[model samples]
Target: MHYVNAKGILSNKNGMNLYRGCTHGCIYCDSRSNVYNMDHAFEDIEIKANATELLKKALKNKKEKVMIGTGSMTDPYIPLEKKIQSVRESLELINKYGHGFTCITKSNLVLRDLDLLKEINEKAKVVIQMTLTTYDEDLCKILEPNVCTTKERVKVLKILNKHDIPTVVWLCPILPFINDTEENINGILDYCIDSNVKGIICFGMGMTLREGNREYFYSKLDKQFPGLKEKYIKTYGNNYGIASPNQKELMKIFYKRTNENKIMNNPDEIFEYLHEFPSKDKTKQTTLF
Candidate 1:
């Protein structure tokens, strides 16, 4: 882990990455892709030492409150976060200034901030976006080695639902031959349905493989799956979008199940929901006496 003095915190879209790179060790992490030009090792987390100060200033200066999002490029609740407390402090600042909060993570450590999330939701909104790629426990361990498994993530989602904090699921990076089967799709959707997630964001029934991540993913495949790397190379042949052969059938299941459950499956609509701030009057009314 390393620290750097950051010049800014939030993006123009009001999203922030408190850390650079990751430690979750997901085999298909897009952040590791060369397009991002990360200078450090993938697991060596880059902490924005001054992120909190920059965030406080940014939030204070904003004329209107907006949803503050994180964990787009890096999961905010990575293991190192347990000690750094950067995410916790960011939440405290967001709650202090009365801004909505949303984060994408695969860690159960999010439960530790339940109190703050609930507080912010009461005033504005707090959406927890979790990624669930594989439903099988053993496969989930192999695909997303370091983070909490799918069942634990589902449990976290259910807990968030019970607390009245809305949740969304990112059902993505579905490795073609590895986890793109109808069974895998159905299993993950079942978890979403049981959890009562507000939405499920899936970018089709496939994953991408660019320069950096493609190489890393192939290496892991060679070690874990054995002979799968040769198959991927032959099948994909340097293509970016690695679509599943079962994409059509699996997407049918994805749409049918999500529609029947009334969960939002449209990415644009879900993103709009995540970004939209609650009406100020509604927030003011909550505290009115």
Candidate 2:
């Protein structure tokens, strides 16, 4: 991995990606795409060495106690997190400043920060999000090689939920003719229901393939599942949005299950829930956990 001082830590939307690249090795990782213009190699993992300090400053100056989100562009609980603890330190800042916090990751290592998460949630809000693409463990290893499998991630969700920490699941990039099936979706929903997740954010029952990610995804398809690349080429061509063949039926099952389960299936509502700062609740504010 290479290190560099990042120009800025947080985006205007209060999202921060401390590392430019990821080692989690998710075959469908949009971060690995070339359009991001990451000059460094994808797996090499670029480190924003100044991220923690910059985050401290950003949090200190903010008057309102709003949410600080991460793990959108890269997973925060990647292997290097244990060594650097940048995400941990940044969380310390957020917790200290009485700001809300949320992170989306596929790694179970997030459990390591349970104490701090509980503290933050006690005072404000802290949401833990995990992405589960496949319910089958073997398929998980191939889809997301470096991170924990779906079962382990679901276990983390259960543990966090047990502690009253709100959880969300990202059921996305459901590959066409691959893991995009009713059984897979049902298995993942079972985990969500068992774990008592507050929300499930899924844009649709499909994946996106652009200039940079399209090439990498096609190459992986060729190597991992022979003859799949040609199928994708014939089906998708140069177009970007790669909707699954089972989109209609899968979506039907998805909405029905989510609504019946009372899980927040609407993306807009979930985003609002994540972004809103509940300053009106003085008892909650006074806790200042």
Worst 10 residues of 2 by lDDT: 280-289
Q: Write the per-residue lDDT of candidate 1 for residues 1-289, one digit (tens) a residue.
A: 9999999998888889999988889999989999999998988899999998999999999777788889889999999998999999999999999888989999999999998999999987899999999999999999999999999999999999999999999999889789999889999999999999999999899999999999999999989999999999889899999899999899999999999989999998888888888785654311110
Error of 1 at 61 (Å): 0.6
Q: Candidate 2: misplaced stretches above 4 Å? A: 282-289
TM-score of each: 0.96, 0.95
| Candidate 2 TM-score, C-alpha based | 0.95
Q: How much lDDT does each candidate structure score?
A: 0.91, 0.87
Across residues 1-289, which tens digit of lDDT does each residue of candidate 2 receive?
Answer: 8899988887877888887788887777777667789787887878888887898898889877788888888888999989988888888888999998988999989989998999999998888988989999999899888888999999999999989999989999899989999999999999999999999999999888787777888888888999998988889898778899999999999999999999999998887777766786543332111
Q: What are the RMSDs of all candidates, in order?
A: 3.5, 2.9
